[model samples]
Target: MEVKGRVSNSTGTIVQSEDEIDLRRGPWTVDEDLALINYIANHGEGRWNSLARSAGLKRTGKSCRLRWLNYLRPDVRRGNITLEEQLLILELHGRWGNRWSKIAQYLPGRTDNEIKNYWRTRVQKHAKQLKCDVNSKQFKDAMRYLWMPRLVERIQAAAATATAGSPTASASATTTITNNNNTTYNYNNNLNNSFEVHSGNMMLSPAIMNNNFGGSQSYTPENSSTGASSDSFGTQVSPVSELTQDYYNNVTVVNSNNNNNPNPDYYPQVQDQLSFLDCITSPSGLFSQQLDFQSMEPNTPWIQSNGDTYNGFWNVENMLLFQQLTDNM
Candidate 1:
């Protein structure tokens, strides 16, 4: 086809620029496809204008690029998305929203267009099969249940950060809070049950450390009744007192009274405890909460916990406590 075109700048004046004036067309051949793919894989996508020139392809940069991506790419898996792939697409789309590219990341060899189409067709089909409206209140409710734990974890993490006073406090508190929140949120939202005892223990370490630091100055007894009260409260608050002593011992200046200090051994004990806590509370430790205990499906072993199976009152109370602790952290 002999195509005629005029090129102009913003002012509507006919510009004689060679870059704008030149136009090319024709069916892409094997040689063109090979050239385009080789150039792209080496140099990477984008800069389409330069691609046509440097790659020595007669086709326009747009056509060469589109052909390569939509058909000629080696990784492009050309087939219908299988049932397994469809489920993955639905789950990923539910979690990530309209992040088609990210969804593609999970489905190797699948194009964005393929995933998008599969979602539109298969999501609706499955929704109808389940006798539910894809855009209805129930569908949204289902999605909420699906993604709630992740959302809750993020909220708790933010709360922890806002309440944190020092870098160590902030880092340690945020991690602990997030871990606990993830456990609690997943258990409550998925399994519809109260999480195991470990949730409380997660908060115990950070709480103890904070309390110890806050009470450290009151370690010595004074003649005043106020001083006596302070010492009583300070000693009684072992967890908090231990944390404060550890913090001060790590950072505080040593003085003439250091040798005579009543709690000279306190800091080392707290430090040891902190190390023990750190060893156990690794990032992977959170995954245990995600185990689907009631799973019956052999291939897809993770079953979503139904709300009807657990006590509503306890769930509400636990969620409230989680929110409150997160807020005050």
Candidate 2:
């Protein structure tokens, strides 16, 4: 249909085109979807306005773009979001608030719209139920301290279970990290023995238990038979522990010997318990630690539940802990 001049139709609202063709909306039909897919496959994507017309699709350019990017694309991943992904979404949202496209870059296969919807439906709902603003420090602290740790615990549990039948395979889940000082540390994932992901250099070890937030205590898995010895940092590394140590050693090195002559005393006790506590409490410092973006699964959808049963997250124990934490906050 071609635009002739301004005219009013059933609604008596004057529109730009006199003989305007009614554009299709709502869910796309199978034929329309196939046409779009075939057109793109033959000619490639971009120039959405002309592509829509050329492809004989009555949908608007923006609509077609959204549909392709969010749904019909070959690489669009679909399924239930895994625990690892949930942790990542929370972490990324904290960093780049409302910048969905930027956050989507880190989480491969996930569309920005999906992430935004998940935040609104799941995260914001929980915040509303708690009777606090989603951006409030109290709620953020609850997520950082309580919810996020719970997610990490779930991810570890899932990973452990996934590799359970293959102890040999799990043990092979190791990463070699090189600090800025040119010191290389080989990390292993010997989850059976201990939760301590020791750096080969014995630099810093962080605990990965439910309540051990930044505590230096060593943890051994149930019925494990091994123990740490000299040069014992050869176990498999959990994502968080590995990322934390790598970030500290490579990104934020504090050397007392540097003659740059400033407040070198800033983090005097970098390797002490207090520093670990600081890492835990400081939201900017804690979640900003880079994750293994490659390990993230395809676009998966996850939702958090209300009180009494939040995907096994909000038990009496966690509720009490959250209260105690918020009170402190």
Candidate 3:
């Protein structure tokens, strides 16, 4: 099955004949995708260089590998990133920074490239709007105190909505949670791990968090100063079922400039307005050590309003607050 071509050796021996392979480039065609898929399906993966040659694909090993992993793989999840995923990404990035591959490992079906793209396109876009370095203390604090908490709230709200939408599904999930000895339920099957429910509080397995999140020790309620079930973030947190309707109805942004008047428009509608960042300073040791909440101005313009179209990450409150603050500056 070998294709032979002219060959010569310095020793005047034509021991073997080989031809230089003309590797294909650019976007892969359907035929190439099918070829790669079929080859991998039959022979399994690995040995990419030889696999490419054996499969008769004109593409290079690296290109084939990227295509398979990023797109053609059977279990590769697609479409928009979910609220749960967004939360996990923020948590993981907070822990690991730009270790995209490491972060991708925890997020099932998500490729490192996809995660990197999301960070660059969505997360960093918001960071740029904030007019601060992504790595800066102010930005990180804004993420931890404002952005991450809003994500948690949205996750809780979404879970609540899903439960309310289907009584049968909710009942089944409840039954599964109750019967399981480990007290873990993976509501989002797209994720690699399970969510632990204990006394109506959603608990992430310290093992899952520590192992995939690049830590050795488990994060527990005991770790939180507030003595509530907490994630790695050290904030007092709870599950969806435990949070009351008032919790959903009440998210306020106080105007630091105008006698701390509560912004009436700040109530986040779970379906639309779920993401925002405020200038509120955090005392949590989870943020940077050098960050002094006392020294910073009350109405710092953390964001610039360019009238970007509203994505799930940016909402009216964020823009309004930013615009107001920008005016003051």
Candidate 4:
């Protein structure tokens, strides 16, 4: 195929190739994909136009490059993005605005096009559902508070299902919950590094359950063997305490000296009467807290519904946002 052209001077004139071979366009075929792959594999990539000609691919340099990078590349990950990937995209987009290329750097194996499509389709659709601009603060808050928690729960549930075949846990199937009284916490307003994760049960550092109740109470599973009794933290914890250990699912605790939790003055005014579901489930309203991402524990795992441990971060608002999701999923 030849493309005839005309010539013109540089002073507001058009110059074209006398005869240029026409390049192919539109959808790539299997042969083209295999050709691109074999060419890159044998000769490596560079000078893409020359590569395309050498490989006998009827495509332009730009077309060849786009096809290779966005579609035929061996490393390009396809299918639904994981919850972790979605969270990272959301966090990065918030930080860098619409710089999709830069955002693509953080998410390995994902192309900028994929992230943009997801945002425009799912995220923008949600914003439209709420009748708000995609760039509005309300939409961002919805992403932060609602969608993130949902994703984390889904991730946790999936991970748990995957690991369900592992060895039977000592704590699983026992309606009688155990509390490691040896376990201690900092139920105070300063929740940085509240408590370290131990062998079983996600432990609360400063006592999330103690905010409204009188005095600090730590539930130790070891001593939880006997019938309920008033013990260490000055509150009554049951052996099969409705508030069991898994209350701290997908919770990301920071080790910051929270001079800025935003809710330092806010106090929880609840009764001692609580259940396992109560501790993990989100309150009726959105609970806001100032979170400093610097203090987070990297790659910390959470316990899923089946007593299996899985890795994911708490969305950093309130802990119970995804509580109901475990059972529902």
Candidate 5:
């Protein structure tokens, strides 16, 4: 039987180098594996040209070795590694460094590629958590506990400029301008006090200020008018009362919805019990009727009740859940 297979090597007229040879390309089957293994066993695994000739196999030595190690090796564990393997890779890389191939050797099923990917992902995740850009100066400062003093001065100058234009700038505008002129003195004083309080352990980097205070905070009129003025220091200041009132009103609406149901148990345990009482009392007292029905006939009403009861129950539950979530906010 003249069974023909794809020719492993092109029979070229020119005797060219190995690089010039075109090996056969196809999926390896059990027959191919057996032939390759037998060839390796007989030849003792060296000299690709001689092995290919003697074994009647078409693959190069490098290809043969890759196939054997990746697929046929007895110790090569298959399938994906678990979360435990991922953590091990992180810890090992942190301690021993980025020797991925070496790390893969320890992880029976893990590939070097997998380890490298995991490391890259973990680094990105940590960088995000720290609120520092991996490519920015803040990230470098975080990694090395040091920052350019000139950069700090630039940040201070920017802060002074922002303070001058702030709403509070009207009240202590003169003091603020004077402070801006004498920023070096005030900065030194503040830095000294902060250093004393933290015992030099907590160095307030520009990164921390940028991350925490760069965004909006509770704006007090005294602070707003005294923009960058030391005179407002130690003064009683509350965030804009209007903002707080609006927040509370929104909370009240959510709370009202939560307590409208007859079934108080549906509401969150942390919900203000007093607000739940008010909700049940308000809105034409519908929940009162539901409460009466629930108490008088439990199992009988459960079957006979229309869709109204269920809808009201769920609506109230949803409102209560929203309130519970908002209360923390």
Candidate 6:
């Protein structure tokens, strides 16, 4: 009966905890945000646990830290990521893999959480929709050859529009794509290797995206206008499933002494000098060394190539050939 009586006065018997005040959770309130910001402004950042306590924020240290680093920081940049920023994110992500914090270091004012969100929501969404592994070889190829070019085109388009509106911008805006590395860039392609297809408008072939895409390798004037002379066009079955796909899109190779190819058997065949650097630019060593591409079913139509188009899954041999053709291009 005594124990029962003791328990009956729940409020009286139980000593109030030091943190008896209400602890807020979930989305932050304007007042709470102001409190956090003002407290940080006066005291500066760090010592999150003590900061939260002294700041009068009814939140955990981690919560306060996250809000400050991700949002409240004076330098933090929000809103949609620009094309240049997007390219950097992809490149940095490729180099660092899931190291969001490390990747964020390269992007000024961009938060790790923002980068992670962009990768998961925008980048991985494509892979998920395609039903392919985000870390597969096929998917990587799609990103390099398909998606990347699309990003480049968008950047160029935006630049052009901006220049047009100002009228003071030069044609150099379109021709000069800043190198990702601090060094200079000069693209091998004359910016007209083939059809100027936008990523949003272009249709991707399922067969070409499959791991066994080889049949589509035999691209010609009827298929790709990549400026490859008709005589230079030849069919070669390339096992891209094992082939090395260099992520250094248009990374310049410096062979000095004013010399020609010392070894004709070198891996990448030497090509004619470029009038300008490859439009694509990325900070060197920013992305993972090289990642395998993931690929799956095509949900859209393929561009007309010699009147041969795929409406569904491809045959094994044809799929392989398609991959080879894409590789050749």
Local error of candidate 4 at residue 227 (angstroms): 42
lDDT of 1 by residue, 21-85 (tens): 44556665556665675676567677786898788776567876667555654334443443224
Residue pairs in clash, model 3? none
> By how many angstroms RMSD does model 3 differ from the true structure?
17.9
Q: What tens digits encode model 6's per-residue C-alpha lDDT throughout 202-265?
A: 1221112211222223222223221111111112211210011111123212232222221112
List runs of model 1 lying over 4 Å from the truth: 1-17, 21-31, 38-47, 58-66, 121-135, 140-329
Query: Could you tell me every candidate's TM-score relative to the true structure?
Result: 0.36, 0.56, 0.52, 0.48, 0.30, 0.49
| Number of the candidate with higher lDDT, 3 or 5 | 3
What's the best-to-worst order under TM-score? 2, 3, 6, 4, 1, 5
Q: Relative to the unseen true structure, what is the C-alpha lDDT of residue 83 in candidate 4, on a scale of 0 to 100? A: 52
lDDT of 5 by residue, 81-195 (tens): 3322433443345435678876664454345766677656754454465455544544433222211122222333334454455453232112211222232121122221221
What is the overall TM-score of model 2 with all chains considered together? Answer: 0.56
lDDT tens readout by residue for model 4, 178-276: 347644432222121121111111112112322222223332322220111111221333222111112221132222344323221121222332232
Please say which candidate is ahead in lDDT: 1 or 6.
6
Give the CA lDDT, 0 to 100, for residue 150 in model 4. Answer: 51
- Determine which window of 10 residues in candidate 4 has minimal summed lDDT: 192-201
Candidate 3, which ten residues in sequence have the lowest lDDT sum? 191-200
What does candidate 2's lDDT look like per residue over 220-293, in tens digits? 32111111111122243323333334443444323234332112221122232222233344554544453322
